[model samples]
Target: MDHALIEASLGELTAANSRELERKCEQIALSYIAQLVEPQFDVDSADFARDPRLICADRYWNLRFQAAPTLATAVDCAGWMAEHVVAAVQDPIREKWAMGYAFITRNSVESAAEIADATADVVAADDSACNKAYFAALYHAGKLRANFFYDELEIFLAASPLALAAGPHRESVLFTALRAFAAFGSRTTVHQHGCALLDQMWNSAERTFAATDVVLNGLAAGKDFDGRAQLLRDRSAEAVAAYPGRDILHFRLATGRWMCGEYDAAMADIDEALRLLPAIGWRVSHELLQGQYLARRDAIEAARAADRQARIDRDRVQSTEREVDRLAGEVRGTVLRAVELVTVFAAVIAFAVGSLNVSLNGNITLADRIWIVVTQGVGLLLFAFLILGGSWFIADRLARRSERRDRPED
Candidate 1:
């Protein structure tokens, strides 16, 4: 548990030198694995893979789970996101919640409902407290209801005449008016129904757009943060156009613009948004947004600097390694020359010994000499193979380790 020990263990995992080192490295890896086992973190395995094909961000995917514009694309995108979510959720009960969510996103509401029911059955089967799961489900259901609610109202409003003199259903007028009670000072009555319904629909859309703006603004302000941001952008843009001069609407548009890489426009909108936010007390969210925006910009700059340094380090390492290899090759040549001299001297001594007792040497037999020759040849071949194999393995491992070290984290 010592901090230095853990740090050293992590270092070994990155550059292990022996089997024992590797075993220790594996133990260090398990420490991180233990973190994954915690239910809250929901770490996804596939997402950690080097190359994850990502679907381009779309607004609807944040919602009542609208499909991508094309059928095939929707399947591909939703499936990828679902896989990541499932991998992230380790708990069986919670994992199913993730699955239900992914299914709802890719399929029809009926299909989504079936998935949700199945997820509930799985949770119930465990006989565990699923109060959290139940609440999560309820909250999402409410959002989904809200998402569709305005769409329905919009349709109803379209059919209704501008003036009540045209005559629509009393029930529709009554319900719409009830929903609008807070927005417009008075409820819609048959007597003053003409303009009230239209006002109600506009007010409803404006409120929906405002709520959407908060969520999206939070998301856009965070680097690599996805979800609801695009939806906020689309909905708030519409709201701004529909209800001009609601300063926050313009602010939301500018924030969305900033998130999408339109920095100039975003600055313009933030200028306006800041002026209006004082009254609404939305400065906290705006402050967080500005902080995140600055942080990401700083991160980008830091990453570029780190990348340049890594390239320089890699070049220096390769140059040093080449120098060492060249020196080693020169030394190898000197060793070969020394070995050749020794072999020549040994052969001379053997020949001289044989000549002193030619018949006795003949009696010693050609097979003996051939045996000596064969043993030397085999020994030399074995030595060569061992040297080459060991060097190759060590060099390959070092090269791979160096490459990994030199690679940028992001």
Candidate 2:
């Protein structure tokens, strides 16, 4: 194996993307596997590990497993790669080999546990580079099955600060740290630790925009429970500026703005993201956010209309009450006037009867006097009935009019 050829091949593999890369990686791994089985090629020699292409091939196979459509297929490929290739890899590269194995074996508790044990051994050896690789592998393995490895993840995070001090591993260490915090950190600690980690990355001149996006995106997904939408918006804005033309970053920024109640700005950002990549998912997201903002605006308007109507109804009810009180007062005055007239009429009738009795007392015979008294009594009774009945009719008419006026509108 020529070293220059291996370097060129690995360089090509790194550059290729999509289906072409997959095909090239597969061909390379199979060719290596064929060589391993050949009788002439010594599998146990240092020459086997000397060619960096073997490690590169291992990485390609890992990529192939990751791209597998189903977990079962991925696991099968991972198992095959571990048995045929990874097990034969020499010591220094074995940590990377183990990390690849752990990544694909995540769905299986048994296989994953084996990888974890291997990772622990690598970590115990205290090789800075190897431990970094091991921790990265551990993080990837636990990422998909966090519930199974929560305790181990916590312990790893506890040692992250010291491990991250070595500049070569800082990026990988930071990535694992973000994932660990997102998965296991408390709501209070998630934002605190996440922001602190992000700040470190941002301040580090060596950090790449791509690396910064990873932490930002991870924090966005995990820290949703914190309700610090404004914080998300601010950080996402920074990310957008740091990584221009990354549509995903713009999308995330839009989401943050939406959460912060800046709908118009959010929509503008969403539109820009869509312009960059007009996928159906982004369109759907755009419509959903638009609908929410419109719904909220409509709800506010409806509430205002309802409140205004309530005020109008209250004023109308007060006016009606005032009118009813005035009608009641008029009724009282009418009743009092009727009472005064009746009293005066009764006094006049009483005085007339007394004078008639006195005039008849000396000049009239007994029969005549009796006739006069009977006739006068009947006349007085009729007069009194007429006066009282007329007063009652007027009062009843006024009371009925007041009731009609006071009746509520339908």
Candidate 3:
């Protein structure tokens, strides 16, 4: 395949409807698999690692797996990465493969455990904090999905100090540790530990409010929301002062005020946020908040309208389902009738064949026998085609009926 064509197809794949995208991806993947299975294709070559087609194929498969996480895709992709990409590559590419493997296997405990076990030697020997932290983050992510792998989480946490000592990965290690603690640590202790880590990270010489925002977001979702609003408010004010004109800080402040039941203040901040960042999503969110505020003010009218709309929507859905079921039943009946006709036709053909054999006997001319066979064969084939065609016609009619029924009234 031409690289430009492949790239264009990939772009189209991204923009295609979900059903069409799945079909396109399957076609692309099969093409890649064909290429991969060719005897001349060098799976171990550096050139293969750098090949654009191979890279695109890898990305396509990864996207498919990410879109729908399944054991089969995970196993296949992991195997391909390990054998065809990782094994053939060096340094940065190899590191990416390791990280990719960890990410792809995060949902499967067995796969993740295998990865940790396989890379233990390298992870132990490597003194780079960034690499260790990267690996630890991967394991920590896996631990989140697989509750039985607390040991993996512990191992990563143990390596945190090494990551902290090395400056490059200090923040990453801390964030990963915070995530682990939030996930598995005792609720009472986890919050305190997270807060301490949050403080340490924020108060460091090179302070990152963005990172602090991440930790605070996690904390906001926790059980202890009593003082979190105040904490968020203080942080939001500080961040705003530090990074003036940042819409996100205003959004953060709005979230804090919303949580604190200060709707007016929250709306005010949301307005500012919207003014700074006039995104459709933000507008939708603002409108939703406004609706909520309105509902709070006029509960009775809002509830009545909501109940009426719910009933209308429910009845519409039920009606559509009934229509679909009716159409499906008709299709099934048509199919059954077609089957019966085919069966009857088969019996008639069998009877005719037997009768012809008896009448013709061994004395029949070779040309006559050939003619009879050909005519009977053609007749049976034509009848089979008619049966199939009739069934499809019924199905098509039913589908058209369904589409007409489903179309919304203007």
Q: What tens-digit string does per-residue lDDT give for candidate 3 at 1-410?
A: 56456556655554445455545545666565556531112233333123433444444554554554443343344444444444434233433333344345456444455444444533444344344334344434333423434334445444544223324543453344345335333343445555666666667665544444444545544445357778777767677788777565676776666666565666677667656652332112335444433443343334446666888998999797987778787778777677868766785777587557845778877877777777776777777777777776876777778677767779
Q: How many residue pairs clash in each candidate?
A: 3, 0, 0
Residue-level lDDT tens digits of model 1 in 104-165: 44223233344345344434433221323332332233233333433332333333221121
Consecutive 10-residue window with the lowest summed lDDT within model 2: 38-47
What lDDT score goes with residue 159 in model 3?
59
Candidate 2 overall lDDT versus native? 0.52
lDDT of candidates 1 onward, in order: 0.40, 0.52, 0.52
- Distance from true position, residue 110, model 2, in Å? 7.1
> Candidate 3: deviation at residue 379, Å?
99
What TM-score would each prediction reach against the true structure?
0.27, 0.42, 0.37
Over 4 Å off in model 1, which ranges?
A: 1-226, 237-247, 256-265, 271-363, 404-410
Question: Which lDDT tens digits does candidate 2 get at residues 1-410?
Answer: 45355446655654454345545545665554445421112123222123334434544545544444232333333334334343443332333333334434455443445545544444453434343443444435344333335344444444543223323443553444444345434443545656677667667765554455555555545645565577678878987887788666776787677666566677677767656652332112345434544454454345556666887999898887778778776777777587757755785677477647755688788777777767776776677677777777877777777677667789
